[model samples]
Target: MPFAQIYMIEGRTEEQKRAVIEKVTAALVEAVGAPKETVRVWIQDVPNTNWGIAGVTAKDLGR
Candidate 1:
């Protein structure tokens, strides 16, 4: 089994998130030789206010 956890600042469309999940699953299947059915992927959408970059919040950076 292969598990993937992805963290990113919130605000992406549902389509984009779906793409992320699909692509991640495919990548894991290819890289680790895991069966597609055994792959797990989850996305964590962090608020811009809670995500920091370069000592500044993503919200403050206009992310």
Candidate 2:
């Protein structure tokens, strides 16, 4: 089995997230020869306030 974990700010629509998962799974299947059914993609969304970059939070940076 192949597993992928992606972290990003919480703002994308459901369709976009689904597309990401599908694309990531396909990539893993092609690159690592993992079975399509055994590929797992997990997306973890964090609030802007909880994500920081440089000296400020993502919300403060207008992300």
Best by lDDT: 2
lDDT per residue as tens, model 2, 1-63: 998999999999999999999999999999999989999999999999999999899999999
TM-score (C-alpha) between model 1 and the true structure: 0.96
Best by TM-score: 1
Task: After superposing candidate 2 on the true structure, give the runs of residues whose Cα lies further than 4 Å from its correct spot.
Answer: none
Tens digit per residue, CA lDDT, model 1, 7-30: 999999999999999999999988
Q: Which residue pairs show collisions in model 1?
A: none
Poorly placed runs, candidate 1 (over 4 Å): none
* Ten contiguous residues with the weakest lDDT in model 2: 26-35
- State the C-alpha lDDT per candidate: 0.95, 0.96
